[model samples]
Target: MSDQHLLLLSILTPFAGAIGIVLLRQRPNLREAVTLLSATLVCIIVVTIFMRFDNAGLMAVDIAEPLPGLKIRFEIESLGMLFALVASMLWLITSIYAIGYMRQHKEKNQTRFYAMFAIAIGSTLGIAFAGNLITLFLWYELLTISTYPLVAHAGNKKARHGARTYLGILLGTSIGLLLLAILITYNVAGTLDFQQGGILAGKLDPAWSGLLYALFIFGIGKAAVMPFHRWLPAAMVAPTPVSALLHAVAVVKAGVFTVLKVTIYIFGTDFITSSGANDWLIWFAGATILLASLIAMIQDNLKMRLAYSTISQLSYIVLGALLATNTSLLGAALHISMHAFAKITLFFAAGAILVAAHKTDISDMGGLGRAMPITFGAFLIGSLSIIGLPPFGGMWSKWYLGMGMVETGQWLLLSVLLASSLLNIAYLLPIPARAFFGKAPDGTTHHRIKEAPPSCLVAMTITSLACVLLFFYPDPFYELAMDIGGTK
Candidate 1:
């Protein structure tokens, strides 16, 4: 089949599954089976597309414009390929994890949850391959609306509150900042197409360029730069699988990816560097990284801590993007892949612990390592990856990011990267350390907290193993990421 046809199918398959899930809701097992099958198929298609991609060519499809100069489209590009790879691969891990988590926790609306998950992944693919600002904005909003149901799947007061925050911030930012940015770009440039080296270079007033930069950065709320990050932590009321989707799989990844795309394809790196527009951006990213890490240290809830970790990790991408150097830009792109595998693995293990032990606080995990050794060991590996330590996939991305810092010769940013890495260790490593090394306060001998369900174990292990594999063979992804912006 044509790659364009497959690209369109990648978006539609999940939606098709969602509809099928609703039709078969009376049969829970069948509904979930459909979810698993469709998710697997989507991943298969994504890989096929990647393998077949003419590394140097663009595969595009365009539908009619709904209005003048605006249309629906999807394309195969290096950056979008990396994104599709992450979203599709993680969907498999998450689906496996969900089978165990939803069943063990006995979550309500099982069919609805799986259905929404399908649709969300679909929209993520839409965003990944979107050919222009108009296509991206439509799919971006679609992703927001699609995942809202999953955020509130619990239907509790906490879930409702989280849903409101998520909806409010995302919609508010998109309408308020993102839409305005698009209007301004079209007004100034007469087109909304994203191009390498940027369409706006030398065209925009150097002073007003900063305003455009601000609009794009804030407008794309998914990047979750602080002030905009409350929505993320608040959304932690979601089920762990949904949290996995939020932090690792689709939602937040989409946000940062959009920012990276805009910075490279809309503004052009040299233009940003010359305009000094990125000077303020670097500080913004550094602030978010440091501040979010501090907040994570204070969060007792394991998932909330991870949510904050996500906020901080996301800034790594933002920092690389704003640095606007080739190495830094590559680091930003690589981080998107590395962070997805590492963070999703962490979330899977967290979900496993909650399912088996009914515990959520780090303090409550004393000696869980004895019973859930495999899960915790994997968690530890994922943690190491996040801290950018060796033998795992995350090291390469951070190495590149740090190199980017040095390339730019920003000592302050170098310090920021170093300090943030230490902070990552403080918050992430402690969870597994406490799980294994910590002693129970009451001195109760609780040895029965075994590994979570087989499905959860299976899922976490797959992602954790993938992390190590990535460290050894990140070339494929590296090639695609470098080629995406044509930065290399």
Candidate 2:
């Protein structure tokens, strides 16, 4: 009943559910029931932690001390609480969406898909709640390993290839760059525990901090900074729900979240700003934002385009972190939630199209929206949010990010953000636009195509509505984000 126990339980619940899923594999309904139940419980647990975050005076839970002064610990903070809430809440939604998708698509090894999905969620929570570098590293790698099977779920050459790239880039970056950075950090600072103002401020030299910061930046490959970003698009051979997981719920979120975490808690914004450690690195984030948006415009496959979009969207957070301003940090943190709801809705719509219309390419989707209006409608809402347009959740985050640029007098980066929004409009809005207004390739009506299964529609509806609701009521995320900067 203690908060510490609940903290531990939050990580274990999904793993425990995975075991139950395997045990009930023969009974498809029971397996799915277990998945839903587990997801629900996680939501409840994380929400409880959120409510008590300000009131109950919860203590950090130390699971082990692997080495002297190096402990595997879990602690709840405003930022972690935000990420955990997003992952937990979306896990439940994604589970509902997956039930419809896998069943309707008749995906093989359904049990394995559900099981690996649970494990991945478990790993994500581990990363979110990690109090120290060691705990985070353990969970980060687990997330990569757990999601691989899902990426290769199709068991085809493409799936296997995508999964391999996914595994290779993530592991290579973490072990080669991220782990090295952690070691260097511990060597310099004598501790890996995340702190409010950062432990490396006085310890690491300003002259060398840029190099060390680069390690952390490129090391967290999931943030998809260019040249290191191929893994994300390659992994698009995965199922749509998995794509949703990768983009919104867990994988990419973890990457940007870690970037923010390291910036705020490891490097300290003041130190980075005063030291100019992120001066050159800020461009990488900016370039990824612009270039990835350009690449997204050229992709024909909906999910592939979305994948590239994700790469671009993620850099917004990375850029926010690198900017090292409180407003920028707040924007970056809010984007974590805003982008998640909008992007997941878009992916859900993509999956719905695949299921109902058997369409993948945008060129082939013309006029199909006439038949599957709800799916396309949801897609439109999602697209607008991603574009940072009015009456959408995504606008607020972009507003703050732009303000951050103004506050810092980074006019060039401000231009990049504006240009990226134009590119987002160019790439994202057209899918739904063409679906509704453009003509089909054969010039035939899509009278036979229908909406996706009920569950899929339900999931998409909820997320799309969230996209709108968050625009009006982003207070919870906004407040928590401000808390990260000690502004609350």
Per-residue lDDT for 1-488 in model 2, tens only?
98898999999999999999999999999999999999999999999988878723536989889899999999988899999999999999999999999999999999999999999999999999999888998999999999999989999998999989999999999999999999999999999999889999999999999999999999999898987999999888889999997656599999999999999999999999999999999999999999999999999999999999999999999999999899999999999999999999999999999999999999999999889999999999999999999999999999999999999999999999999999999999888888889899998988888789999999999999999999999988988899897666
TM-score of each: 0.98, 0.99
Instruction: Report the CA-based lDDT of candidate 2 relative to the real structure.
Output: 0.93
Whole-model lDDT per candidate: 0.88, 0.93
Off by over 4 Å in 1: 485-488
Best by TM-score: 2
lDDT by residue (1-488, candidate 1, tens digit) is: 88878888888899999999999999988988899889999999999999898766776799878878777777878888999999998897788889888998999889888888888999999999999988999989999998898888889898998999999999999999999998898888887787878888878988888889989988889899987988888878889998886656599989998998889888889899999888786788899999999999999889999999999999899888888888988889999999999999899888888899888888878877878898899899899999998898899999988998898899898898899899999988978887788876567755877779999999888999989999999998999878855656
Q: Summing lDDT over every window of 10 consecutive residues in candidate 2, give the lowest-scoring window.
A: 50-59
Worst 10 residues of 1 by lDDT: 440-449
